[model samples]
Target: MLIRDLPEDVVMEILSRLPVESLMRFKCVNKAWYFLIRNPDFIAKHLFWATSEKRHRGLLLNREHEITRTPWVSLHSNETLEVSRYVDLLQFFPRDVGELVVFGPCNGILCLFGVPADRNGPRDGLVLWNPATRESKALPIIQRPAEMPTTFPFRFGFGLDPKTGDLKVIRILNLNFRRCQVEVYNLSTDSWRVINTSVNPIYRINSPRFPSYLNGVHYWLACERGGPDHWLMLSFDMSNEVFQEIALPSLTERPSFEAVAVINDSVALILAYNDLATRFYYICVMNESGEEKTWTLMFTIGPLLHFTRLIELRDDGFVLLRNKNGWLVLYDPITQEQRELPIYGDSFQVVSYTETLVMLNGSGECA
Candidate 1:
């Protein structure tokens, strides 16, 4: 059948089934395809299809950085695989020597902002990267006219601002030494502008963790305008560049670790705390009131459960990197299952994950 003979909606349906990686590369096929893929409606449709198809996708795990053994392993079948076997989808950085620390992944893109390699430059930097396609674009620097206070705690967020057709990076800089200021970067104009908020709030670090992106707004937990210790949640509207606060469920005391996760397609907070004896977790679904309903107790690690690190995996569950009998076991709380993913590196650190992508620090052993 000729290309023009196909119905427009049917053609779009076929295109939407293709993975984002393939669609991105096919943009070069023609000007029409390029414009179609770049359209906001098409992007939303593509994301919906991708998420719907991935609800039951099998897990692919890798054993990274093995000196005497292979570099990758898959968890789905309880088998070890070679990293070189999937080089097309897997990219490795043997070492990362930059200050652009990454905090979270959003819509398959990772948010990163520049830090000094060695404190040589006058300004900090920012960028958003898509590792699957190896595509990244650096953000323009947003500067404050005066020197920022020493106690300033800053958080960065990136998303598309639909109103202006510009991708924006919102920076929340909390200045305890002085009043804090809100700054934003517009990718289209490559400029930073300071925005004024109605009531200045003291940023809260111990409250709920912020989601990467939601409804063109980035949310953060902050101190209420009433007092220093009183906690509140703040949302930055990317398009309007305005700040608004959301109310959350009333708790007797704040949680130690920020409870944040993507639950049921919505950003939910995983409220958790641990005393010396035991660990307790509450999975709370967030609503417009900032209140959490449907409170569910997820897990409790007894006093004897000694884990060195806990990382939330791409599968909506988390892995506990802990030692059991001198062997590292990756524990899944959801399934109450554990597998020995032997560690072989001297100082092991996880860089990131893409699908089943795993990259170890040095030498690691896996079963």
Candidate 2:
């Protein structure tokens, strides 16, 4: 049946369920769908559902003998359940791209940033891609300063303004030691505007691990340096376009291992340390300081989670990655449990959880 035969609301509902690929393809099916799909509200609705569906979905990249392949896989909700391996897509990536790969997924779109070859060479920028739909938009290149420190690392986040519904890309450049520079690009303006600001001691590029989206802002872990070497918790607010150091709750002693992530719809910091009797773990629930009250300690899981990779799952929960019988296993942190996801054929390094996708090592060629 023609889409026109369906009610307007029904048509939008149907469009929202289809992956981005089907939506883009359906746009060519008729003029009405083309106009409907392009509507900002419809795009927002599709992005909402896509992000929800992607949260539970897991992507695996298997590379062997110099050949790499990445396939999107989904995890069953059951903690101990096993699901069959499936390939959502089977395609080879172009070769000689870059050494470092970072996945910044916003809405249903995944933006890839690559590490630059040298100071004079083209720096890493944004490329929009939809895995579920396999449709992509290669963004224009943005200027990068060549004089920055060579060894320093940078962080990137893709966000949308919930107020004006504008799509933007934010890049935080951390120089050698602890210097930071913030730059924002709006798709509507197609220009890069550097924010005037100075990071206190300097923030280091923490692992791409705990960065997440909530209430239209992207939050990640950064060290706010005070003295020559001391570091504190730093947060980058994407919506209001500001950066501020957070004061963590008072603890007897700071944990040796610290991670920042979003949990239960709130920004949280997980501090872990080893004590003589048992391993100590503490979670600090975050809320705007003056807007509300104080930092609350949620839970404390013992030494069992010493070396686990803690990540916020796509399903609004969390997962712990550990080696099980030489295979990687995922455990849910909240329930204090574990499960095995059958990931095989490791040719290239695969870094992904749910919202953050994976990009294999390759030469610079559009896939």
Candidate 3:
């Protein structure tokens, strides 16, 4: 029977199961389909299916170009590193938009901040991109929070507000060693607002852990001030717009973290410490509900692999690492195998990426 002859409910089910590229083309199939594809409810439904565990997974690998050295990120198969979609990030913006700071893929929407190469040419800007649909929206700039006097660069954290289903990005400005100015941008309203809070002592979510936005919260592993350097996780709840401090396991009062990642929707830290001149990686998961947070040591990784740098720890049994040759490698914990990628760059930026129908509202520039 023709797709039109199928019941609308059955049709929705079939369309939702199809990949995002297929769904985008179906919008041109018929008026009924075009409306169905654009429906917010249907978009959310499609996202839910796309993120399922049984579905085939991909990686969003961000690295500098091997030859020209221009920064670019691409979508590739998790196992083979076979690129399916290549995104030349700067190509989407005006010539002066410049190099970009990559943020989250929170529900498939990875936000980018264009750091203008020529200040006199174009202003520094922000772009919301869904690599799956190749749709991008240029966000209007608002008055940013005042800069912190500290020489360290400020940061932006992105996440989906669980309570409202709204996408939000937070700009954190460290005011001192003590206070931080937080500014939030809401995607639905396309507006920015500064948050008022008594959140104290300026716990920072550093760059090494910038990808830690999981389960509606943004997290960073931070070191306490003074003394011998203690450890804590600073988390910002997107829905509540509040910050919380989570203590780590007391292992000589320090845990050497390689990276922070989300596994099965829970935040996990990859710890690399030396054991009798042999370096190893440890996975620790947190229990967030109790009065005191607990960290459970999940497992240990090693036989001293030739990996020179630890890039990222993916949720599934894969670890993205780099070697002395400056190439990326995917390590599977289950198979105890390693596969090297073709690209060559020193920048270690790779994230486990899943396709989604989010931000395909047809209101943005077709990427």
Candidate 4:
């Protein structure tokens, strides 16, 4: 009647339901259990259960120390929003302020890099990390391909390659010539290669902080180059590495700010307009199941009620908001309850993550 005596499928079902920390320790119990836990199919199933059940969900927070200015990355429980673990990003990069960890949670893999101490310093090495298993793979610094110098920070996104199921890091540099020079780092090959730039859309990937990668595609609120002042959702399919653009809802006047995020496994467009009275957020979710993509307006959160901006959206109807005077708040519309989060620091970075053994020992096929 022991777990080991159970049928293979039954054991897997029971083990998959357990938390990642327990499964990690269970791996050494026996050779058969070790192999079973490491199997790609088993890992994917466990990840599916974790995500669907919302059991191992955590929020990654990137912030700097208020007194020392030291950069730190921590994982907090999604339910409690309390810090569970801390990894100083300074250890990953030599620079003072490491880049925000917003690039991922793609199959529990994150792209980590350094922000130059100033605008002129060189970037440090890039690393792919899985906080769940505490394993990381560091890549060589990608050298700038363009001969012309530019001051813009290299925009990077991390996602799963749908075809190969391998992890990939996308580095995009919008050159002055209105073209994007793209390089992709494939984790399976552990190398970086430049993809063709001729076919890339001329739209500039809008923001560095809030770009979202859901499933096998990366989403960004982009601006078309040399065209009308229309906003577009620029998406790159990781499987084919093809660029596609989805137009946003045309407005009589441009929004003061635009951002994109993945909510409920769909891309959401957020347009914020500041008027004389207060700021308003136009929230829309894009539906792609049809022959052509369509946008649906979801909500219009507004009137600047204490919270100045929307930071995170949860499936359970909780909205994370931020104050203009430095406070993190959460709003539950159903209960009409508002509470401030204990987390603090400047330039806060938050991403939802479901713990998985994807990058255990920094090698495996990601889910």
Candidate 5:
């Protein structure tokens, strides 16, 4: 029998096993195949199989320099952490936009915030990009409040609302260390709505660090002032559009650097103390979500000499690290082994990446 004559279920099964690049080209063969590949149900099935099979493992490295570039480094082995290839991202963006800040990669779509090279150029500053399919959509410009201070730093969080299957972007305008304005943009509506919820007065977030998204929620490391340094985990639920705080484990001394990340489907905290004096590092994993008592010390590595930043935690007992010299190194906490990856770049921002066929047109609809 011919390929086209195959049953719908069989066709979908075969298509799901193929890479996204192949499927994108296959869609052009015929309208029947185009609609079939673009179907929401098929996309979900492909994603499920891709994740469970671990087929799309890679590293997205953002190289910051005169001409910013994003290169996707494919990971082949967890033990060796070998780089398979470096995929250039220049084709995914426009010519005029140079500097782009990537937000989240929830469900394969990366939300990007960029400014035009020319200050007064006409362009959509915000964009949604799907690297697997090479599809991108520039979102409309957001209007700020009249009274909002010009110098107020803006923080953004991107995630998908599992309840409604809507892609939402949460923007927080920090007017000061204590108070701020919050807004949410719904992809389906193509508009931004000002959320009346105010951030907790006791906690203040570090805007320079990006928020981590896991299971339809965004997490940020926040600190409380006045007495001793108190760090807390701040979370925003995209499904319900609400905010909550989770307390961190007690610390004798404030960590010089701290960030929140997801490890093995649970929230994990990476803390580094006094880089100048101490070579000790700490990794704390939460046994249960939203529970302060469940936080447990996972690992403590000592004499790590310049390994200062934790880029990501791998499933096979290894953690990706960035030393003070700014090189990417793979360190095994269990075996006490360390090796530097052969990725050459001036500056690198690494993020966990998985390739998918998720559409960026609107919500989950195909363009």
Candidate 6:
């Protein structure tokens, strides 16, 4: 009747249901447990349970010098938001790496990028980190094209291929005003390859905003190269390694601001319209992924005094918003209530993440 005497399947079922923090500690109990926990099949099953049961539904706040994790709870209710834990970047990375910019939490792996303080030093700014496991892998150095401009803009996105179970990191570098260079890094191969693709001249990926990964695709809000006159949704399929453009709903007046986030397993677009006379924000959700006509306005809030950005639309029906001051605020679309979260930090970035033991190499085995 002892636990170790149980069948392997039964042990796996029990272990998979445990939290990641507990599972990490349990791995040290015995060599058998260690191997079992590190098995690729076991890791997948554990992640399946973790996501399906909503075991680790929380907010990953990227601060100036640290990354803080907190539970996303109802603001109107008695539930309180507290920092469950955090990781200091300086402890794991050198300060001379410049400012750390986080890319994604695709399957619990965060893609980080930073510029080296010394231009002559190493340029391998890409780092893949798993907060739960505290394990990280540095990607190979990226070669700067000789034709690159002095101040070119670049953005990074992370995604997982469901069909092949591969983790891919995509970097879109704007070579010039009209040209873009695309590069994709495959975790399974541990190599970076340039994608020979041409982007439309009228549309450009907005580098200031992060891309949303859902259903094996990464989505970004693309606008007219220099102005906000036109907007479109750009999607990249990780499995096929292809890009597709989806037209957005036409607006009476071009939106002054726009952002995209994943809401309720669908793509949601937050549009803000401002003029000298009035200003308003609209929350539009597309029930279907690629269907442009499905874009319906869910709710409209405000003619506020300040400009606000949409951080996320939580599962509990609350929207995480950030104001001009960079403070975290929770807005309930149903109740139409707004309140500030107690997390005090400058330059806030939030991402909806589920805790998992997914390794950076796309294999459960330790690298």
The lDDT per prediction is 0.50, 0.54, 0.72, 0.74, 0.70, 0.71
lDDT tens readout by residue for model 4, 82-122:
88988766566656663455577787677777665554665
Candidate 6 lDDT, 146-219, residue by residue in tens: 88753455677788999998888998877665677789998878899988775675577775344388889888
| Cα misplacement distance, residue 120 of candidate 6 (Å) | 6.3
Q: Give the higher-TM-score candidate: 2 or 6.
A: 6
Best by lDDT: 4
Clashes of each: 14, 12, 0, 0, 0, 0
Off by over 4 Å in 1: 1-9, 24-44, 55-98, 142-146, 149-153, 162-166, 199-201, 204-210, 223-229, 252-255, 289-307, 313-330, 342-367
RMSD (Cα, Å) for all candidates, in order, is 8.4, 6.3, 2.9, 3.0, 3.8, 4.4
lDDT of 5 by residue, 1-367 (tens): 9987889899999999887768888988999888888888998988988777867655555545423443333323333456545544344445455455677778778776764455455443677777666577767676555665543446788899999989899887765555667889888888888887858655567642433788898988878766346677778999888988777887777675468877666677877765666576787887764453467888876557754666667655677777777677778887878888765455555555567887867444443
User: Candidate 3, residues 4-37: lDDT per residue as tens digits?
Assistant: 8899899898888887778888888888888888
lDDT of 5 at 207: 46
lDDT of 5 at 220: 81
Q: Which model is ahead, 2 or 4, in terms of lDDT?
A: 4
Higher lDDT: candidate 4 or 5?
A: 4
lDDT of 2 by residue, 107-172 (tens): 544555544434456554556554544455556675556766545556666766777656677777
Q: Which model, 2 or 4, shows the larger TM-score?
A: 4
lDDT-based ranking: 4, 3, 6, 5, 2, 1
Report the Cα lDDT for candidate 3: 0.72
Best by TM-score: 4
Residue by residue across 157-261, what tens digits does model 1's lDDT show? Answer: 666676765667767666652466667776566677778865364455332233345667766655554475465556667877777766666677666435454
